[model samples]
Target chain A: AQSVTQLDSQVPVFEEAPVELRCNYSSSVSVYLFWYVQYPNQGLQLLLKYLSGSTLVESINGFEAEFNKSQTSFHLRKPSVHISDTAEYFCAVTLYNQGGKLIFGQGTELSVKP
Target chain B: DVKVTQSSRYLVKRTGEKVFLECVQDMDHENMFWYRQDPGLGLRLIYFSYDVKMKEKGDIPEGYSVSREKKERFSLILESASTNQTSMYLCASSLTGTLNTEAFFGQGTRLTVV
Candidate 1:
């Protein structure tokens, strides 16, 4: 069985500050990693994904994540976060051949204060 | 952009009522999923469909049933709603392939069973 672990349950950061949300997974097989964001009342949206090719994957909204195979980690980072970035983020994983059975972490609540 | 539309944004139902939650994806995705979102628990899969009339039980499918009469629409049903099932429900759609494609999600439906 595969599982995802998000290190932080909640992180409070000031506006324009750098932020890193740590995530680690336990899986013996190769897996695809994803970062999803859920706004106040919206559903979870894909922020970034690491399928193959580069170990680093980035979302257009200035968020990026790196896949560390040896460490079994895929941490999301942002150079500077805005107040609008305050939301709950989830880390998820799906096996290579499993289609889309995503196993998710407990989620991290990132609060950006202006 | 992939548009995954959930039928309802919020719903309040009495316990023991038959509840139906609907989802539709416009991207002709081969896979659609239903997940329950609770605080601290992240998202747990309830059911998923790979094709029309084909379904599979997910992590927590005990009290949920799904219907996929069409490729673009997936429905989640609760034969008898319970207070424990009162939480946010999410729907997602993804293409089926070996590359492990990313999923697109709807804006979520918040269901409260009293």
Candidate 2:
């Protein structure tokens, strides 16, 4: 079994400011990490994922997340946020042997203010 | 691109009524999932199916049941709708195999139980 924990429940940042959303997971076996963004009244969209190879993964919209195995963390980051970036972000983990059943965190609401 | 479609965008139901939420995937993915999203809680998995006629309980499956009769369609059932079950429901599908697989989500169905 795998569990994901997103530390921040809300993150308020000004436009053009860099922000980081912390996430940690606990699992005895190998797992896959993912970040998803949900806009108001919509479902979630994949932002990035960390499976193998590089520990760092990036999205096309300037969002990135680093998978730290030692710390059991996969934190999402963005260099500069825009007003449109305001949304709820979720951190998830899937166990290797569970046939890809995802467990998500409580979510962090990112409010990018103008 | 993978597309997951939910049956409704918004639904209003009364308590004790039976409710069914439908989901269909166009990608022919082998795995389908049903999850509920709440305000404080990000997303909690209710049920999942890896193949037709195969279903598994997820983290929060007590109040929900699922059916996967065909390959492309999955349904989530609430035997007796309750006020607590009023939340956003999301359906997702993914390919089966590795832990790194990404799941595509639908636009979500907001169910309001009164």
Candidate 3:
């Protein structure tokens, strides 16, 4: 069985400040990593994903995450954030041959203050 | 673009009643999923269907049933609705054989059991 752990339940930051959301996973085999975001009263949208080569993956909305094989971590980061970036972020993992079953973390609530 | 649509956005049901949540995808996806979302718990997979007439139980399948008679449609059923089942139900779909592909999600259905 594979599982994801998001250390932060809520993070409060001011506008233009940098933010980091920590995520760790436990799996015996190689797994694919993903980050997803959900706005208020809406379904989730994919932020980024790490499949194979590049250790670092980025999203168009100034969000990026790096996959660390040694530490079993895939942390999401943003250099600068706006008020519009306030949402719930989730880290997910799926094994290579698991038939597309994505296991998600508890989630992190990013609250950006103006 | 893939479009996943849920039957209802908001539903109010009485306790001990039978509840059915419908999901439909238009992109001819090979995978469909049903998940429940809470404030702290990001998203927990309840059931998934890989192909027509093929369904699989996920992490949390207790008290829940699913039907996938068609390729584009998946239905989640609550045998006896309870207050604990009052949460946001999300439907998602993804392509088959893609390791890094992101799943497209519907708007979600907020079910309130009173």
Candidate 4:
């Protein structure tokens, strides 16, 4: 069985400050990694993903994550965040087989204050 | 761009009532999923369908059922709604392949059981 663990439950940062949300996963075989974000009262949206090749994947909103195979971690980071970036972020992993099932981490709430 | 659409943005139902949550995807995706999001719990999979009439139970399928009579539509059903089942429900669809695939999510349905 695959599982995801988000180290931080909540992270508070000021506007324009850098932030990182830690995520770790446990899987026996090859897995696909993804980061999804949800704003207030909104559905989850894909932030970025690491399927193959590049270990570092980035989103258009300045958010990036590095897939460390040795550590089984894919931490999301942003050099600077805006108030609009305040949201709940979830890390997920799925196997490399068809009909793959996604296992998600306990989301980290990023609260950006002015 | 792939589009996943949930029938309701918000729903209120009484306890023991039968609730149906419909999801339709514009793309011809072979995989469809139902997930529930709760505070601190992230997203928990309720059910998934890889093809028409082929459903699989996810981690939290206790009080939920699903139907996939067509390729583009997936429906989640609550036989008897309970207060604990009140949460944000999300629908997602993805390609059948394991590699280079990403799930597209709907806007979600907020269900409140009173």
The lDDT of model 1 is 0.94
**Interface DockQ of each model:** 0.78, 0.67, 0.61, 0.64
Residue B99 local lDDT, model 2: 47
lDDT of 1 by residue, A18-72 (tens): 9999999999898999999998988888899998999998999999999999999
Q: lDDT of each structure?
A: 0.94, 0.92, 0.92, 0.92
Clashing pairs in 1: none
Best candidate per DockQ, number? Answer: 1
Candidate 4 TM-score, true structure as reference: 0.97
Q: On DockQ, who's better, 1 or 3?
A: 1
Model 1 TM-score (2 dp): 0.97
Interface RMSD of each: 1.0, 1.6, 1.9, 1.7
Over A32-86, each residue of candidate 3 has an lDDT whose tens digit, in order, gives 9999999988888989999999999999999999999999999999999999999
lDDT of 4 by residue, A48-102 (tens): 9988898999999899999999999999999999999999999999888644367
List, residue by residue over B1-114, the lDDT tens digit for candidate 2: 888999999999999999999999998889999999998888998999999999999879988999999999999999999999999999999888744588899999999999
Q: Give each prediction's root-mean-square deviation over alpha carbons.
A: 1.0, 1.1, 1.1, 1.2
DockQ of 2: 0.67
lDDT by residue (tens digit), candidate 1, B1-114: 899999999999999999999999999999999999999999999999999999999999998999999999999999999999999999999999877888888999999999
In model 3, how large is the Cα lDDT of residue A72?
98
